[model samples]
Target chain A: MSEVRFGILGCANIARKVARAIALAPNATLYAIASRSIQKAEKFAAENSLPASVRVYGSYDEVVEDSGVDAVYLPLPTSLHVRWAVTAASKKKHVLVEKPAALDVAELDRILEACESNGVQFMDGAMWLHHPRTAHMEHLLSDSNSNGIGTVHFIHSTSTMPTTQEFLENNIRVKPELDALGALGDLAWYCIGASLWAKGYKLPTTVTALPDTTRNAGGVTLSISASLQWDQPNKTVANIHCSFLSHTSMDLAICGSNGSINLKDFIIPYKETSAKFDFTFGAKFVDLHIGWNVRPEEVHVDNKLPQEALMVQEFARLVASIKDCGSQPSRNWPEISRKTQLVVDAVKKSLDLGCKPVVL
Target chain B: MSEVRFGILGCANIARKVARAIALAPNATLYAIASRSIQKAEKFAAENSLPASVRVYGSYDEVVEDSGVDAVYLPLPTSLHVRWAVTAASKKKHVLVEKPAALDVAELDRILEACESNGVQFMDGAMWLHHPRTAHMEHLLSDSNSNGIGTVHFIHSTSTMPTTQEFLENNIRVKPELDALGALGDLAWYCIGASLWAKGYKLPTTVTALPDTTRNAGGVTLSISASLQWDQPNKTVANIHCSFLSHTSMDLAICGSNGSINLKDFIIPYKETSAKFDFTFGAKFVDLHIGWNVRPEEVHVDNKLPQEALMVQEFARLVASIKDCGSQPSRNWPEISRKTQLVVDAVKKSLDLGCKPVVL
Candidate 1:
């Protein structure tokens, strides 16, 4: 609560939003920022209103070594997430790695272990789950008034690929270590986090990955799809999909038992709403939208990045949990590591095994 | 356990398959057949090699009221499912009604309540879950070998449409009681059953529906889409876009952490095994089918339904579950009822709200 001091690892666009969020949070402050280039870092430091005492490190190692930082926010490429996060944690700084902490699971597990052994905090920066919209979604989904809309079964989240590529987006499209998964690693985490949060964090019992690893200028995914099941008290299954090759997906589509809620275009201001299907006893008619039975309506617009803000606040909240909550730390480390690895491993398996299901 | 003596409520196509399954399973028998004409019922009874003592009824009411029967299979039009099933339950008989048991939630609820209160059983004759293919899907998704592929995320299941005359022959499409829901109700249930059974029987917390209710000379959906979320231990989700309008949609696409599996024209089998999309995780490059992904080298198909045989074994299993395990009745009643009503209500609400998320 003592002005949660924060440091950012890059000057990525999202980093700007996240930094802005840190500044906006009443108890949070953007105290430091680092980049390979001093000019960009200086620009970010100045524009974001960082204090004079707040320093810019040309090297991330310097930033990670900085004792002034309490939490390190990593906003680097998918491939670099693990290396930097583990380094930050080893230096005893709490880490908030960007969504998809690593390109694959083995690396993710290592980072998680480093956090545990080093006794530092670790959180995936999937901020959407922290948004009020998500809280409302959880409330809407769990409310009995929705009647039999029991489990949340699917999430379709598509963040349109940036038309204007940044200078740093190299090797994302066609490299062995860094391949098509950049899109999946980036956009998919939202769907994963959203679904995980919706199901009250039920771990998937199984996973099967399907990737649209179409090479070259054709780009990432014409469309990619995957499926998994959860074994728990209620027993649920899910399918999540992400694509960076199309203009079609603009939102998250959440389908439940009793009805459906669409968080239209989560990355921008777009249509958002909930819809129900009609079925009365023996005398009613089935509902139809226009000529069809399904359609979307806008109920809210998230013009601001509340999720990023809440994510930092939640990180703040986690610090409290580590000190006072149950015997376990604020986050479920082993579980998160396993699940994260499960996703990345699933992706690798798909490329190796030709995209059939494998048990988690 | 005493036999679950099933009395047929119609001479519909699916009834014959159920009858055959009844003959194969323990503790169940197809005792009678009912139609508008006793001749049609008698003919069906004879063709299927039923006992001469098997009664033929000219009206559905007689079959529901028969004291010799323990349960009645209601395969009448969508409009009549609730009326007959509830009445049969009221008469202290169990009911295994066909899909989309009612066009709306109110009627479906009434029927459910009636059956629950009467201490009789109720189930939807949803067949796919009873098939072994889904079990394989469950296995592939949960196993760890498939992990590098990432989590199973998205799937779209589609079933093709029948012509105007064909739809009118089916009660679900032309039933005045169903009104606008028609095709959405028809096609949505299969996807519902798949998602529910895949989840080990849990309802969705969020449902987003978008329907194409255009009648296209057939008074049914030309295209329909829905977004579902099942956020349990393993975060999962799906987008279901179907068409009673498409000439063909014998496809179910599922992606996983390590791979993906697809049932080719499952409900209505295509002519060749080559029509399938059975995939798993691996590191080699794979070819892509124009419309669907093709990874046949590593594909493993659990069961491929010959359109004719799809319902036969499932109906048998439902009968066996009811008779052999009276304590639990049908293994899938709660799941079936919950999913059926969910889809029905979702369709109604989507129509009313113009395809928006209707919180359960």
Candidate 2:
């Protein structure tokens, strides 16, 4: 329980961030890094300033074979997620997979089953959910608090980043053979995940892709918009926009009957140690509807570590509990990842049906 | 040209605000007020502290008939706009009608035609359009400057207010015979208008209503969500959510290829004299992607007069120009209102078709 050793598979650009995250996480250690080539693994370790004690492996199998590594962080391409994640899980290593979790729900389910069978902790690398600001917003969204935002009615979120022409043409994300889902996988994972999180992981009854789906020449989505509608206990609708052709933006706005919350930098904070969101409660128009009675109050939350490090630390804590105390792997994180992947699949299905509504 | 005389043709709650706006507008004067009964008009005048010099009339016709009144502000229900607006135009009075200018674009067209034939100016009472903050935002949205938000790709806006059950059942806005369109007409007008304004009045290629449309017992839409897609010289998508079921919110966020802008109180400012919006230009994730390199900068703009007063002043300026300088009536305001109404009709049509996409 002293430290859950993390072995990172693949030398993806994102893996470098996770490497730093593991180094920052007090409860987690950067034990090993693997790439298709030993030189690549060694170069990644050097570039990220990994300590000499960290192991460099030529193959992902070597990291999985190392019994000292308790967890594997899979930052591989979406197409290779199922193979590597399932292999890591089968090796009794807890899994922290980068999102879009998999190319589709089927692949995600395979990885999930492997983790469940092996009694390994599972979580997707959605670092924002680990931020202190997210917890602060969740407190306001809780149903037990009478003063919180009343029964949620609407949620809007977007994850967009401008990509250069060269990146669009050559990057792994937009390449059909590497990241087939393209922007829908790379960017919309955040937006769709945020929506599901806001709704407490209640799967939507229907998903409809907007007509504005833009595709690259290789039939990969470059930009897309979709809506998820929940028709059960209380009707709620969530709209998400994800694109690789827009300015960098990560906006999340949630409105309930009695209040609303909004944050512009929901995916990544402007600063590493602090974040803020705007919350307006019991807002009413002043007499004659000239102005609001109250303005949105800025609520600031500070964190001792970056959200990525928090994610690593939390994953390590869960893995440690299971390894040391013989506790079962918590289903909470896996369930969240499953539900988010299910919605992602639904969105893709909706698009496949020519922007028609896909009933869940 | 000293001051264009103004007359109000209803005793609705909003009329009180416009009466004050007319009084505060330097180039406009509150010359007359009208209601179904002289006693009601006199009571409204007394309650709103109207000056004794302001005339009170028993019927809307009297306000139109008064040769001294240069313009009439029609704050009547949506059902009454076409009739009153046409009558005022025929009487050589410039018309300033409250939004959802008419129940449908057909009625709006008739009203516009009447104003055109009579050589009288026409403007919708969308007060937010006249705010100094709007002009400042417009400056940032302009394509002339390379530093502004470049080629807007997505726009998201919401106009929602929590309504009491009694209001949902009895308020004129939700009553089938009074406003008819309910939240779509009353609240969505601002959101739809905002989308159009951000896009420089370019009509969307298609409109699709989300399945979360909620209706009152009288079959009036109480809440609705819709997306407008523009497929032309550039591809842009806009999502709008308007409801009488959620907490008060008027949010507008526009994301472009180079920058983004966001404001919470878009329809009405949180304060009367000043407003602020967050603008982030050239935003990029820092190396390692842990956080953004730039945060949204708060841009504040102040106005000497309330937005409503500024609206009245602008309308009066146009009216005076026509009356004193023998200038032609400007088509800009009427065209803006017409485009907005067209989109409103498209949204309603899509809802009527069971949330299908309606081609514009």
Best by lDDT: 2
Docking class of 1: incorrect
Name the DockQ score for candidate 1. Answer: 0.03
> Tens-digit lDDT track for model 2 on B88-110?
99989999999889999999999
In model 2, pairs of residues that clash are: none
Candidate 1, residue A69: how far the Cα is off, in Å: 1.0
lDDT of 1 by residue, A1-360 (tens): 367678889887778777767876766677789998888888888886777878887878878887778788988876788788888888877888877677777788888888888767788876555655665556656746544334444434444332224412454433336444655666666566556656666666656553333333534432345555555544344555665433223345444434455433344322112222111111111221001222223344242435567678778666544544522445563465457556656655655576545656
| Candidate 2 C-alpha lDDT tens digits along A1-360 | 679999999999999888999999999999999999999999998988899999999999999999999999999889999999999999999999999899988899999999999999999999999999999898888888898997889999999999899998999999898899998999988998988888878899999999899999999999999999999878999999999999999999999988999999999998998999999999999998888889889999999999999999999999999999999998999999888888888899999999999999
lDDT of 1 by residue, B194-229 (tens): 665555555665565543234444445544556566
* Candidate 1: stretches off by over 4 Å: A47-51, A143-148, A152-180, A211-213, A217-223, A230-237, A248-250, A266-305, A320-328, A333-338, B1-185, B188-360
**lDDT value for model 1:** 0.59
TM-score of each: 0.50, 0.99
What is the C-alpha DockQ of each candidate?
A: 0.03, 0.90
Worst 10 residues of 1 chain A by lDDT: A281-290
